[model samples]
Structure formats: structure tokens, C-alpha cells
Target: MEAKNPLILTVRLDERSQRFFNEMRIKYFPPERNLLDAHLTLFHQLPDTNETLEIVQNSKRGVFEMGVIKLINLGAGVAYKVDSQELESLRQDLKRAFADRLIPQDKHGFRAHITIQNKTTPEQARLLIAELSESFEPFTIIANGLDLWEYLGGPWKHRGYQSFNYLDK
Candidate 1:
């Protein structure tokens, strides 16, 4: 990978929940353009450096349950809103560490979500949202760890995973 490529950090969901979301994403997202399975990104871009990897690996967040609380309309897509105060705290910790290097979007507030459909027409998105809402019920998913990825241009390559160790595994 190029040294200049950015890194992306995401919360790794449990296997069961991840499979469920991946299915939804595949069913709703445009197949031809979908680049990744469903995921909740914590940081969109971080300098590809050892310091970035070290900071993430040293995170102290424990495994926690995150609520897949709400279904949201992304105007041109659909997503599931996830919530966890613990997750927010983790983001704050990393945000402070990368204070000077943060991009505009990462500098602002962070909202956790996993998009199921995107890059589609608003009308198509609305229809999917309506269909999903009819059967949607809030659920909780386990956040097992952090996933560090090397962003090569627009594609991502998984680098490593740092599992949360607060609870016995």
C-alpha cells in the first residue's frame, strides 16, 4: 500500500449482527457499486502512520453493547442509527489524540451508523426506508473491537483488529 494512503477506523460488530447487516446491505445497496459490507466507521481518514496504528491499538474501550436504535433516511440511501455513550467516549479519546490532524468532518461531532443502501435515487431510498420501517424493531449488537484499514484511494484493505479487552473473552 502507498504510504500516503489514509487509514479508516471502524467498530467491529459481532459476527451475527454483521451478517444480518451485510445481507441487508447487499439486498438494498446497488450491487455494481457497493465496495464494502455494512460497517460503522469511527474515523473516515487518519494519516497512514505507525502513530495512528499505535493510538488505535492502545485504545481502552471495553466490549460493549451498541443499540441499532433507529432507521434513518440518508436522503439518497437508508441507514441504521447506532448509539453508545461508551463508543462516543472512545471517539473523543482518539479525536483528542489526532486533534491537529483531524479533517473537517472528523473534527465535527460523530454519529455512529451503518448504511444499508446508498448511491441511489432519493425516491428509491424512500421506498426502501418505508419498507424497512414496517418491520424494524430496535436491537442491540456487540461491539467486539476496532478494525484498522488501509484506504487505498477509494478502496479499503483490512490491516488489523484490536479487540476490546474490558470484559473477559
Candidate 2:
């Protein structure tokens, strides 16, 4: 079988969101060798070839300014607090765009959470969540860019990401 052309997706992130993730990294997430940009992915697992090109070409253009909010506790090793309306709209638009090629299905029913770190032991996860909850307040962020990227591998291995497009608002 032909090697999958690195699972590609498009996304955007705001400054505050990025900072939050960075703080989480400094506090708990292990330093990664090849850390890519922080973004809220809009699409994933897109098939390859001309169809991918067309999809990218026809991708909708818009600006999303999402405010910072607590990412309340997400069960099963996830937590966050937010009721971001703009983020929700962007997500919906993405789902509509890639309805044919990629299916938007999350094992946990799409809980909006910025993944601080994956592959954590239950104890570590709990402790991290508690500490974050204690220190977490609320903030706001203005996102003015959209980007296209391809995942290099699951989440390990060097050269974890490759940027394809960076669209400004």
C-alpha cells in the first residue's frame, strides 16, 4: 500500500491559547524534540492527491476571534473550561467543508480541550489537572491566521509537523 501522505489538516490558534499550552508544557508536558505550532485543527485524515488539492483550494476563508475561558474538567484524562462561540462556529464550518472526505468523529464526543500532554498515567493526569484548575483563571485571545499542516507521525519521532499554508486575515 502507498504510504499515507502524512495525515494533513488545517487549523488556527490564538496567542492566549498558545501561551496556555506552553505553560502546560513547562509545568507538566515533557519537552518534545520537534514541537510544532499550537493550533485548533479544523480537518484531519484527509485523503491524498488532486482531491486534497481541490479541497484545500475550496476551503472557506474567515476570521475567528475566540475569547479565553476555563477549560473545565473533561472526564477521562482531559479538562478545560470554555464556552467559546466563535470556536464552535469555526469547528462547524470545518465539519461542513470536509464532510465528504474526512469524517468528524471523536471517541469522546468532541470535548473542546487543548491537549496538554498525551500518554499520561492516571495519577499524573489527575495531579496536573488539579494544579491547573487551582491556578487557572480566564483570558481572551484574537486569532487572525489559518494554517495547513501535515502530521509527521502519531506524536513522537522528530520532524513532527510540516506547514503547508499560512493564511492571514
TM-score between candidate 2 and the true structure: 0.68
Q: Report the alpha-carbon TM-score of model 1 versus the true structure.
A: 0.95
Write candidate 2's Cα lDDT for 1-169 as tens digits. 8675544554445556777666764555545532643445545566555656555555554555555576543333444444567656655665666667665552114445555654556776777678777877776555554455556665512212323234565
lDDT of 1 by residue, 41-153 (tens): 98998998889989988886678998989899999999999999888888999999999988999999787999999999999999999998999999999999999998876
TM-score of each: 0.95, 0.68
Score candidate 1 by lDDT: 0.90
Ten residues in sequence with the least summed lDDT for candidate 2: 156-165
Q: Which segments of candidate 2 are over 4 A away from where they belong?
A: 32-37, 53-62, 72-82, 104-109, 155-169
